[model samples]
Target chain A: MKFPFTSEQLTKLHARIETPALIVWQPNLEKNIADMQALANRFDAALRPHTKTHKSPLFAQWQLNAGAKGITVAKLSEAEVMAAHGIDDIFIANQITQVQKLKRLRKLHERIHLTVGLDNPRQIDLLRPFFKDASTPLNVRIEIDSGLKRCGVTVGNDLVELAKAVARQPFLRLDGIFTHAGHVYAARSAAQVEAIGKQEGALMAGAKTLLQKNGLRIATVSVGSTPTVPFSVRNPAVNEVRPGNYVFYDAMQIALHAAAPEQVSLFVLSTVVAHPVAGRLVIDAGSKALHTDGAGVTGHFGLPVNIKGKVVRLSEEHGVLELPEESTLRLGDPVLLVPNHACAVANLFDVYYLINEALQIKTVPVEARGKSQ
Target chain B: MKFPFTSEQLTKLHARIETPALIVWQPNLEKNIADMQALANRFDAALRPHTKTHKSPLFAQWQLNAGAKGITVAKLSEAEVMAAHGIDDIFIANQITQVQKLKRLRKLHERIHLTVGLDNPRQIDLLRPFFKDASTPLNVRIEIDSGLKRCGVTVGNDLVELAKAVARQPFLRLDGIFTHAGHVYAARSAAQVEAIGKQEGALMAGAKTLLQKNGLRIATVSVGSTPTVPFSVRNPAVNEVRPGNYVFYDAMQIALHAAAPEQVSLFVLSTVVAHPVAGRLVIDAGSKALHTDGAGVTGHFGLPVNIKGKVVRLSEEHGVLELPEESTLRLGDPVLLVPNHACAVANLFDVYYLINEALQIKTVPVEARGKSQ
Candidate 1:
């Protein structure tokens, strides 16, 4: 388990670097990436992993290098950052409504293979002009709400109408139908996660059949989420799967049985900066590094694990570790905090740590740490 | 009001600048700084503004330039950044415990007039060696918990004990008693906010009396939050006040009656990127930008404002807008959304909108947006 950078280097770097700095582990990251890539290979589906998780240009390169079909971005800025980093194939997984962002999208389309996810017929009309002007028509994917009732066209006739509407646009090419089983993250076990995944894939595949019968060309059937992927591959209709958080699973992922403890790739490395009371020791990391979130409960936001200690409360900049014994913890020790959700935690910092299993520092950047605008 | 940069220049700069860019509004920022300065001056207290709000050297310069006696930071990195910017006076308002951080604190003490807050007696031991090494001993303030029962020495006698402990340390100076009425943000009205402020001031003053009776010299008595200042200034015992969010008040600040609408200096300038339904238009800003926390509500996170049009709901990266039926929001119109909690929103992005009253784009770089790390 020899790491790229020695422990002495990390200690030295720690001295030079400021406290509350983000420290991402490199070995865990590569392992997580390999695991997801293997799952994609097993499914025989295109691995268009979403880039919104890390948001670092360096992480995007890793995903591309890992044999992903393309990148999926939630915003135009994210896509633009990836594009600037020379990532050409991108899918704006959410709808594009803003004219200013649409202009950016059209500009992006001029040079890259840009596709957008659409949930409504009006959205199709909105993108029609850009489709007509492009040298090649922009690819459109109707996002079906399989079970997660957040965004997307509800399964059934509504989805059919949206797909047929896509066919009506002469310049718009209907690439496929996509669905995200976001609800699968709440699954209690692998069995429940698989069930949700199958349902999600079936719904998207069903939408594709309806569209094909309605004289619309369906090229891809996409469905995914970290929790749903294992079960989803069983459905042959799903051509591609997109799972973002699998690369850096968090406390929620573990609680939902999506990933094991060893599979988690990210942790907020913090130091115990203050011992204000007999039982309480405050760490350097706070809401800013760990974003305000806790899994399975309210009030307990970030998951503070005792690397060798236990954290009880988190203030804006200090994490309070409450212990049973007064002398259990020392003043200058570094602590590892597994955040409730990794995606939001990744969004909190400009950079991340790339340490190994032996806690050795490696290549620091994970590519897409702040790809969001 | 005139801005430093024209809209066209801003647009061009935004287009040409690096991807993952952070844009800030200079004029709006100046207004925020000036307003806070006037309030601090009106109260006749030494304004030691919290630098944690905007952890940029440039903004720290603005506060110092506007007549702040000192800049307050929550971590060593923030203090280091401020020190590099030539900010000599700094107060690490949170407790410092880790030996590594104490080592850095000793180094920081050499260049700047540094003071740190401590609540428990255990912290005294951690600071003892660091202060002994520095030519000038480290100034330690006893933080009293004035209703925000998160961190601090809550009891009066405990404060005295901590002060006595500080006095006993060869390297520690017993500065005074300080507390933040963080619960003031939960207050519903101006009167309630003022009452919390006065209560906080009285509690600190009470702790000061306890320390004074113990034969310890308490030089500074401080208590404040953005909500309590106007109310707490009436208490003559308080000598210094540190309030961070006053510079860029948010919708929550407004809802708490802490600030007027015009006094709010920062807003998330996003675009209406998608229109899925006639009433439902989505903006580019989502949970990552506006934050997931609303003022006591679950789904309601940020302020839904009329930009060029209207916004209703905000998802992760998509803000759903409920516009008038007769009107149509095109693909690319930019909208200014005033976030619910400016402090949390500031933590999300790397930059902000430095704007004029007419909503024209100006020089944008609230550089310390992610200085929390």
Candidate 2:
């Protein structure tokens, strides 16, 4: 992986900063945003980029300014944070079952145009007590099990039943049907990702048809997952696309051929603190900095830019890189590592350094980070 | 994994709180701390518990009150946080090479007794500019490689040379030798863990002797790593032991037979958000909350209490648990999951809920969380 910054530029940046810092190259970041938005435009789909990746309201605002319809979050707390930052239209793409969270969600709905995902009757029952007497009905999207079996209902009878359940509630409005093709991360090749993507689109479209046949007025048909957005958005039946990782792609995106190295804007800047042997070097960034989420997908902890090595091991604060014997990387030398997953890596830091093309840095607070609940 | 809390207590707690939260069972937490301290006392070793596990100064204060000599941190930022909270004595068990961090270290040393780990000459060179002319010498510990292989110098000439280099500097004090046997996490059996623990102790003792023979005084001989602490502290030559995870044992420790189920204190209180299939239940906690650091040590993401199932899959905000067909877990049901590694999980949350035997709760801020700079 080649870094976007030159060695001299990185040297000047590293001179005044600490190690294990998250760097967001602004030029690449803007390009990534524009490129993904252009793709959504070409497919005539609204881009509701997932805020779970950047976790910053500032980044969400940038997406909204660059033609995103709104924003998507994985949890209610994240949505609350984004709403607090004046992001009005938000979609929570995960199930919110706990009563306390539902109460918070109802309060948030009064302040913004909030849409939540629901896959089961239990969730609707839980939400009824809070939304039953509200002036505005809560917009809910029926989640369909496209390929990722972690959540969502199966796209046949289960989908129809869930949509009906939501539609029957006077306080609940069945706004759409959506599915996330997260199984694309497991695809061994680009062709496999494409296959899963197409299947995901078909499943969501089929679910929409099934729901409409059952006299449900579904307004939105959305497909999520960064790797599958290209193929899933191609289905004319889908009106919205939510892809988060494309904002700052990482090693896993590269491994799945979803993104090129130059498109990856996020990096963990670390300093080689230990050269223990002939072929091994240790950096200050470890699991706490880069995260271990995509280890299984990439078969490595992270990829070091401009180096022929792999982050083979990670403790809480140490990353052990296995390098070639003659590698010039020495102690105290700085290395930028593209984490296995950018979303998980973004959650680890309180602030990220946004670097412009001139290498001037600005601090961006990850305001919604760790708002997992 | 058996939860320390009763179902009634958990239900009440879950009713008022959000899901995907971290809970510290106070009774179990106190017991784990006492047990480890008693073990260290039995072997006549000082307990410098690593604060990386809890990341809370209040928890560190409890350990110190329970007869801990000092506290150990993984980074300079952690040490700075601990020091700000009036923790006057801290040993950073990792290298500090960055000039900016070294500058901060110099400032931190003025207010506290700070000792840093050093394994190479480059680190010593980095320190010279800041500590060379200081009135108070900065304490430096020679890091010996006791089979972790991530950081630290070898036990022979490399150790001696690093010691000599530290002693040569006017403002740098060669205070001790330390090693973390993290490789014990890879031990396939109890016997293998025991073997690695013994080797760790022997290597540290041997390195101390080698440095002393070279006319360098080594005051502290410390060994770290939770699973190996019991065996390593038994070595008469070892004077101090640092075991962070013993404060909150998790599934990884249970897998290594280091701690039993009852001793586990920390848990991710997550709600079952989806029951997509008969055998699969998806919880709200995932890699963002529980962390994926110990997935390699334990073949599962986490262990659910009172349930005969494992967390089979983890996305950023969802945990997919594969259970038997007879299981009674349903949507909106609360489940307490013991994470694979408590340290990494602690880093993910900003606050931890400390619950007493009476089922009362108090929030403890993870003061040093995200201080990984």
Candidate 3:
């Protein structure tokens, strides 16, 4: 998963395309995809790679071609985009409560084998009317709060109650349980991430058992998140793994010890547009290109792959890099930056300039980019 | 500038459209535009409304119809989009160093009156090869570092040298000098913002004077930024202002005392999708919809307009709102959140839902949404 381009190759490639562009090193991307799928195979779990990272149907198709059971999306709009692109199996890893969106989901479920996450009874109530009396029952996976505290219910009475509520609706089939260990990104060490992952697997598996004892049949047990997938997938009770950021391990992944720096496949090709001082260089890619997600976690906007500098500040269209005093970076020079969070960064671009091992370049549309509805 | 919808109106509108949508109150938007225009009129300066905020050519047209002399953009791609939409007058308030983008800029200049910002001799050199022998000179504005150290040359011998270098190129017209006091966003008080604004105006005017003493004819002297516009426009030497964020004031502007809470025009209409805990409610709008810009400055992701809660954390598709103990927000309820930074939030969506005073809604495309190249 090492960066496949040399300095000369990168400079030549950089000259061919526009700055502030998303560049995917094809070899590294394919390797990362293969490595994650192999990991799922080693654990004997279904590899359902999350499309929320790349947001490209082409990349999702690549994952599926490499033996992914299904694709995972965060929004119904993204699922629709993937379904239109012939991705039949999708699991929306987030909750959908609105009736308007539920109607769209019902329409989408007619074509694809869809499964949505639900953590509350109210969401089941919202789905009942729209899905009721349909020829095919919609699949529902109860979300267990496995240390992320963002979404999902705790693995207790709340979990059993939510599962029972989904089971009560004849049109809504209680599929299984899923948990995303998002808090592992904030883990201080690998050991901490392992602990959270172990707890995540245990909680979801335990929740599955608890619901089964309550006369609810749960088919699939899933655990996800890039950082925690290695440890979480060890549980035999878990049948599916959905790790999104593994496709393009970012600076945050490196900080979490979940990935090596060379494994990062995604880069924002930015040109040094301004050298206002001896130690300050400004790149054309700013928050608009790199995003502001990982700066809070990493304390830096992005990591420069080719230069001895740190992206210290970001405006709308300007990324200010603070270079070492002896650095030789100048104006108009290309700087490849590995964004702190690849998922958020991928959402900003309309297309990705993919470079193969032969240094050949091609453009691929980020089909699901801005599909945030 | 008050939000132009009642509770019933908002409830009805929220039900009609999908959640996690960008909503613009039309009355507040129009009033914000007119108020900024009036402020520019009071100072006898031409209002070149920066279209980087709305990224919509229709909004730029509204500003032009309301007496704006031109539109300002941060990228040449944005200028091309605005030009394609018939916004003939444009100033790219950023430096372009790549030859490819410069060629695009040159072609765009042929179709309209185009000006670009310049800070160093390298940019002047980048422009020389493209505009050395053109039908008309490309308008170049020397950027002076007012207070924000992100970009621009200092108002010293460096400024004189940069301006002289621009004047040396016969094909590059030295039309003006400009500076943006972006550091005013960090001002702790209104007085500090006013002080930064005064220094911004004085430095630009001094640069103009120094350049004129060096035998260069500088037609325009400009200073901008939403917070400093009120104080910066008062300087008589400044003839043009480019304030973008005044179009949709957000939580950051309110924190800087530049905007009242009611003057905020933009909102993200999100539905409560998950109530995992008693005090925690998860909304559909996350960093993907609301953006992560203002979270660093305000210590909150976004301010919930209708709900008495703070969006404490945000994932890619979920916003975690921590509400009061007595809060009654439930699943399926719609909450309007004012983003921390409206410009960043606007970049995330392809279209904005504009709601008029009569509760009518229309979709407007963000024409230059991802024109970051």
Candidate 4:
């Protein structure tokens, strides 16, 4: 991973740039994209990476430039924002059920190579009318439950029936089968994560094979999960991999052994606001600035890299750090924290302070910050 | 607690309205405001309600109009936003340490009744230079540690020294003393909360007496915490009470018995996007919409009051609900969730859907949504 700005750049802008800012180290971010793409290329899988973690069309373009074929979004609102920013090949990883949302999706479907995750044929029935009069047929990917147990049809007859129903619809094209190995996050080791990834790939590839045997054309088999991406991409039958969190690996990734301390690209820059009592120092970064994804396995909400401390708890605007018995970090000292979950931390801020090697400062809006709908 | 929209209102816009939207039923909001104001009046305390919870200037105005003497904010950013909306009586309930922030605070102090919390004499030493030549002397409140070991000086020599230093400064008007009884959130019983509230009032009152005996005339004795407000306001010594979360009583409040079910005025509106499993269904709302405050006591991350299910887990954009064995909730069904923590949930959204008794729908931007800096 690329290091942050040099001492020269830090001199010019470090003190002036506001505290509680989302500092996106440009070099590390670019390195993260390059590393993930390299891994995907080595496995011969098309990197259709998830954009929900970054939620930036600018970053999405960088990923595309690095050989990503398409981008995946979790919400229609996210799809709307990314596509409007000239992101062409998009896949919404969640099902849209509202008629109004379906209408919005139809308008978007006419503009890009859009495929939506659908598990229920009833939803296909709803989409039938909207897509029947469309210029471009909406690609429908049946989301099969590999292990996450969140969304998606279970892998047996239910999966086959959903695909058949989509194939029967003239407007709804059966484009692919997809599965998310999100449960890999709970795995105790990289070996455990690999096992989950293999299951995820098998689930998607096997579903595709099952559909093709039933005389249905299945064009793609996609699987993704940041922790499982390394193994999932290696599956020859898996054509597309969509891991979003690889762009800014966080404390959780480090705990899962998916990344090293040097690989964490994002850090929330905060200042020690108050040294209230013994064993704890309050910082400006709180639940609003950082992610409360809980203290993973380390029992530290975040690693305050600049200070020898662990954020033990947070209020709205205060991070209570449990420091070493005699640590000398004082009030107003600039501190940096690598949050437990980078995506949630990114969503909390409106803009990011992009710091490059030469110390050039760039401010960019978190384009899809609240596009959760 | 006001009932959310009538059947007619939900019918008219239920399908058209997007998921993960903050639904502010104005009737309940108005009722909640009036009730809090009444409670404050019953105790003859100034309802200087903290505006950090619902960081909306519009809601702050409502609180002021309903007899709130002033408003409290946790950050300079929050005060800036509230002041821009013509909110005059603003007390920043946190310390300002940075020279830039102090300069900005000085500028803001010129235009409003701004008081800030400070605990350290070193901070006063820093402030002395900035406020040496001021138009209106800055009101300074020495934040004292009541029970929560967060910010604030301890109750003895440290607290006395800070207050005396403030009183001695020519340009720093020693406003009073403030203590946040935030630890009442850990109370499992009303008696425990009441015990914490009594201690909060005693600590502030006792500190004021000790300071006055030392020739420091204390004007305001303030205590604020949502969980302790019910009892804290009843203490005659606490002249100013600043409970921020009363405007939207959440699941935690209901569990604490600080609020009734009918008093919860705010909720998140979401729709069931998929019913892909046997016992669980997914809503379009996720960690971004609801809070990750964890289960208070009920073990329910969120209470979907409008639906017969509990939100068991959340992904970035999906709330997986555990439905009863034979539930009738279907795909495309509208659901309302009362988040465990209201402040965190409110900060996540950009806008709120205001539905009043008249069924007239109005959209207002969550002005302080990303003003966390």
Best by DockQ: 2
* Ranking, TM-score, top scorer first: 2, 3, 4, 1
Interface RMSD of each: 4.2, 1.1, 1.0, 1.2
Task: Please give, for residues A1-373, the per-residue lDDT of candidate 3 as tens digits.
Answer: 3455778887898789998999998988999999999999998999999999999999999999999999999999999999999999999988888878888999998998999998888777788888887799999898887888888888888777778878888898888999898888788888998899888888878887898899989889998999889988998899999999999989999889899988889999999899988889999998899998887678899998887779999999999999886567667888998999999999999999998888889999999998987
lDDT digits (tens) for residues A314-371 of candidate 2 = 8889999998655787777898889999999999999999999877889999998899
Q: Compose the digit string of candidate 2's lDDT tens values, residues B39-131.
A: 999999999999999999999999999999999999998998899889999999988887788889899988999999988888877888888
Predictions in order: lDDT: 0.70, 0.90, 0.89, 0.84
**Alpha-carbon runs more than 4 Å astray in model 4:** A1-13, A296-298, B1-3, B6-8, B294-298
In candidate 3, residue B123 scores what lDDT?
80
Angstrom error at residue B211, model 3: 1.8
Question: DockQ (Cα-based) per candidate?
Answer: 0.38, 0.82, 0.81, 0.74
lDDT of 3 at B295: 71
Which lDDT tens digits does candidate 1 get at residues B1-373?
A: 1223455554454443332223455565678778778877887887888867766677778888998898888777779878987889999888776566677778888998989888777777667766776677888787877876567777666666667777888787778877888877667677887778878777776777777777878889877677887667657778788888877777778788777776666666666555544566566777677776543522355554443334444445665666556344455444455677676777676655455545455454545666664
Q: What is the interface RMSD of candidate 3, in Å?
A: 1.0
Tens-digit lDDT track for model 4 on A227-293? 8888777777888899999999888898888889898888888877888877788888888888677
- In model 3, state the lDDT of residue B264: 93
> Lowest lDDT 10-mer window, candidate 2 chain A?
A324-333
- Candidate 1 whole-model C-alpha lDDT, 0 to 1: 0.70
